[model samples]
Structure formats: structure tokens, C-alpha cells
Target: MRVNNFFICISGCLLLVGCAGTTKRPVAPVADASSVQRPVQQPSSTVTQPADKDKNIQIRAYEPSVPKAVAPVHSSAVTSLVAQAQLLESAGDLTAAVATIERALRIEPRNAHLWNQLAHLRFSQGRISPAADLAMKSMALAGGDIALKRDNWRLIARARRGAGDVAGARVADRKARMLH
Candidate 1:
């Protein structure tokens, strides 16, 4: 009887959560199922880009942007994996969290964010040297992301302090602080 009540409470909570939405747009009116279908307009080879606000006159109307040489990177899967890893870490299952992060890294091996996360977990597990090493790997992959670089430097500083190297820690700390 208690289990049945618990399930009912859980279901009600899930229904409430599922019904919540973030859309700001007005809802459209529902149409009849028997309504006639309208012809879909296919996009032409030419695509129009918004004109610059500063320039009053339009230079080009339909300029096709250069095709991307590579496929777009999808980070949704990584995000989910990261969330799972964080949950595991928060639950004190450091080994499981590290494994989850490793799975995400396999999908995006060059991702500095994943590397940084793994390094942080390593640090928490008292593996200071490997944490610092992973931080350096993240630093190498931190292209155009100054904040990630700074964070890696901070990790390096922490690792150095853990190893009782005051001078190295100070130098790394200075490097991290220098990054604006």
C-alpha cells in the first residue's frame, strides 16, 4: 500500500515536471486533421543573409556563404555524459565518475572541458601528479578559451602545492592570475 502511494506521488511529480515549458512564443491555434495540405517551399541554392545595420544600402541580396569543410560538432551527448559524471562525483563514486568522463572523452578526445573535468576528479582522488598532467593536456587543447587555460594553470598550481613545490606553485599561480 505504501509502495503504491509512493509510485502515485512520483508519477504526479513527473507529470508536473514534464508539463513545464520554456517557450516564450504564443501558441498557434490547432487545425482540423481533415484540412488540405499546403505545398512545402524548398530552399533554393541561394541563401539570404541579414544586412549590416551600419550600412544603409544593401550590397548583396543573395550571397551563398562558403560551405563548411567539416561536419558541425554536436555537444548534447557530451553534456549529458558530463551531467551523469557530475552526479556520480557528487554521490562520492569517484571511480564511476572518472569512468563516465572517460566515456565522454572517447567521443570527444580533444575536448579540453572533459580533460579539465577528469583532472579535477583526479585531484579530488589525491592523484595530484596525474591531475597536473591531465591539466597540461587540457591546456594544450584550450585553443581560444583563455578561461580554460587559466583554470588549467590553477590546477597546475594546486598540484605543485600538493607536491610541496612552493616556487613552482607560485609561478603557476602567477600565470593563472595573469590571464584576464
Candidate 2:
């Protein structure tokens, strides 16, 4: 029992050390204020200086120098929507997933992932023609990504099968196979 207690204490110490080393320090906030000191202005002397003469010497009122423009924060909506769509698809609610993906598309129309997801949902729902169309669009936007091309070929094959064009389906399947 004493030996077991000693081993447990050692294990606990090791665990604590592991956790301490893995912990991250909080990030410091970015300072937006300029560090440059503003020049002090003195009372003007009786001498009537010409308007244009001293204009160049006058320090502009301390407008806090405009901060550099930052890119917009990444929205959680896209990630959350994609997660919800995946869950709906996994639960066999392909229609719901498609609808969710459509909403995401409105937010990020150029996103290849969203387009591919919608195409997949359409294919699963047996909307073959639309699936093929979406897949083609995704492939075009993805710029020759092999995975997108393969998915496009898959949709084309499915569309051909749905249209009762066995030869077309076979040719599409062959194209997809060639991609490997």
C-alpha cells in the first residue's frame, strides 16, 4: 500500500509538470496610440506673420494618427453553419443540410468547401442534375484541385446514371478513375 501511494504521488507530480509546461500565457492587447510626442505651441508674437509663411511650421492638431486598417475578424457563422450542415447530413437530413449550406453560400459565396458540401448534399438527395452543376462550379472555382475534379466527375456520373445514359456514366466513371 505504501509503495502504491508513492507511485501515485510520483504520477500526480508528473501530470502537474506536464500541464504546467503545456499552458499558454494570455496574449497582450495591441497598442493603437502613437508613441510620438506632440510639439508644444507658443503664443504668437506681435509680428504679423503672413498666413502662408507660418502655415507649414504649424503642427496639425493632434489627431491621433489613424490606426492602420485591419482585416475584418473571421466570422464564426461560417464554421457553425458548416458544422450544423455536417450534423444534419449525418442524421440523413440532406435537405436541411442543403438549406444550411445555401445560407452559408450567401455569406461566403466564393468558398469552395461550401459549394462542394452543397453538391454532396444534392447528390445524396438524388438531385443529380443540380449536383452536377454545383460540382462543376466548385471545380471551376477550385482551379484544378484534384479532389474537386474527382467530385465533379462523380456528380457527372451520377447525373448520367439518373438520365439513363449508361454509356455517359461509364465514360464519366472512367474519367474519375483516371484522375487517381
Candidate 3:
């Protein structure tokens, strides 16, 4: 009986949470079935009719603006974790440092600096592909931080060079130089 009650309580709480999480959008007022107008069926004729112009229908593309460059703010916990990771890396414990950074990332997944740090760590470990990928991710989230993006581009160039793509490395290096 106790187990059944516990399950029932859990189910109810989950249902409530699900409902609370849903957003109520502004719904279009539905016309009554009887009040809705139906199109008249016209007999087939040879006469061509002009296409209907929907004056009320206008389509516009949505363009998202680039975010302005602003320094990222870190919480004390994250700052502490970064410090610890730095210490671990300095002590030749790259694996443990990476793990510590990963923990910080879990706390602030969108932090560009954290992603950049992870990319640098991966680069130091000679994981070329992941290092370049993580650096790209960091650049994507870097907003307008020219320095950070430049650093990421440099990292990507190095990764590309390591992978024997001289042309790709040159392109990345050019991009980094352009930021200056």
C-alpha cells in the first residue's frame, strides 16, 4: 500500500510540474463551425481568374544581431574550480585538470571562457580534432571578444597544422590576424 501511494504521489507531482512548465501562447480565436464561411464551388470554365492577393499576409525574415563584446562574469564556485584546474595542470595532471574544468562547464555550460579553457587543455593534450572543435564552440559563444576569438582562431590554425592541413591552417591564421 505504501509503495502504491508513493508512486501515485510521484506521478501527481510530475504531472503538475509538466503542466507548470508549459507556456500558454496567445491563441487565435476559433470561429464557430456554423459561422465559418465556406468557399463556393464554381463550375469549370475556360475563363482564367487572377490569383488572389493576400494583403494581410506579409513575410519577413528574422535576423539576429551579433552580441556585443562584454567580459564574462564568473561565480565564486566556477572561479574556484578554474583555479584548481590551473593548479592541477601546472602539476602535470592534465587529465584531472580537464575533469575539473568539465565540472565547471556543467555548472555554466554557455561560458565561452570555460570552453576556450577546455580547448586549450585539449590542445595541450594533443587531441587535435577536439581542440579545434572546442575552440570553434568557444568562438561561437564569444560574443564580441576579439581577443578570445583571435585566440580560438590561432588554436584552430595550430590544430589544422597538426592535422597536416597547411591550407586550412593558413586560412585560420589569416582570420586570427584579421582580428588585429
Question: Highest TM-score: which candidate?
Answer: 3
What lDDT tens digits, residue by residue, belong to model 3 across residues 45-134? 334344556334334444444445567688999999999999999999999999999999999999999999999999999999999999
Backbone clashes in model 2, listed as residue pairs: none
- Give the C-alpha miss distance for residue 68 in model 1, angstroms: 24
Q: Which model scores highest in lDDT?
A: 3
lDDT of 1 by residue, 1-180 (tens): 999999999999998887786458888999997796987544344444556765454333444443332222439988889999999999999999999999999999998888999999999999999999999999898786777888899999999999999999999999998876
lDDT over C-alpha atoms for residue 158 of model 1:
97
- The whole-model lDDT of each prediction reads 0.86, 0.77, 0.90
Task: Using lDDT, rank the candidates from best to worst.
Answer: 3, 1, 2
User: TM-score for every candidate vs. truth?
Assistant: 0.59, 0.54, 0.61
